[model samples]
Target: MFRSMLVAVDGSDIGQKALEQGLAVARAMEIPVHVVHVIQTAAYPALALSDLPPPDIAQQALLDALYREAEEILAGAERTAAAAGVPVTTHKQLGHPGAEIIALARKVGAGLIVVGSHGKGKLGRLFLGSTSSYVVDHATSTVMVVRCEPGAS
Candidate 1:
């Protein structure tokens, strides 16, 4: 019933679990999986508000590091999916994680969107909004939120 699946990974253990689960579904359904690692560029602007504004060099350095991390995460996802014998595509994006993920799902016309739950608890979610929760709330496609295992960081 699904054409394709979109999996969002953040290099976290829960994110890896989501990837595994998404790949399992993709394999069973015989559909390609689109893996995405989004660099939350929006957060960087907040650094500008510091008493001593971040120099352009510093900002670029942070962005470069984020891009490198994204590359590694997406490459690892590709390798994992390949080993699992599932067709996969990887995307590196810069934006709010939730928005980028949902956008990619829509762009690919994916029937399912898989994301890992931060499992930060109510207070944590209240203070720092959860990306998975945001996607669940906003995405038009089916969403699977893989919860992080207790005591498993």
Candidate 2:
């Protein structure tokens, strides 16, 4: 039923599953999908590293790396959609993962958002929250969470 779907990927195993699920939904609905990857900046407090000054060259290098990674992710998604015979578009954003995802969903006017519940670990998630949870809490659009079971090859 979704006309436009926004899928978020973080290059994690779980994120890959989310991509697969999102692609399936998009294909079934016969709607175009927009795949987005957010290059997270400063994920956690670097109490020790914070003492170091931000280097211009390092910042530029980080940006370049992020862009390259984003392009690869989008390319993979594009190939998946192509194989599924579904229409697809892509975007790459550099910001807080949660905020960027929500913002892009709104900007795209997507009817739904598909994201992974967590990016890493299996049982470790019992303590930490996931991007999917964050998006579900903050996003205005409907969110679909794909739970990628651990050890699923």
* Candidate 2 lDDT over residue span 1-153, tens digit each: 677999998777777888888888887787778999887765523312436566467666766776898898888878877887777888988667778899999998998999887445545545754577779889999999887676552
lDDT for position 16 in model 1? 97
Among residues 3 or more apart in sequence or in different chains, the pairs in candidate 1 whose N, CA or C atoms overlap within 3 Å are: none
| TM-score of predicted structure 1 | 0.91
lDDT of candidate 1 at residue 117, scale 0 to 100: 93
Off by over 4 Å in 1: 46-55
1-153: candidate 1 lDDT, tens digit per residue: 999999999999999999999999999999989999998866777543446455478777887888899999999998899899997989998788999999999999999999999688879889888899899999999999999878786
RMSD of each: 3.2, 3.9
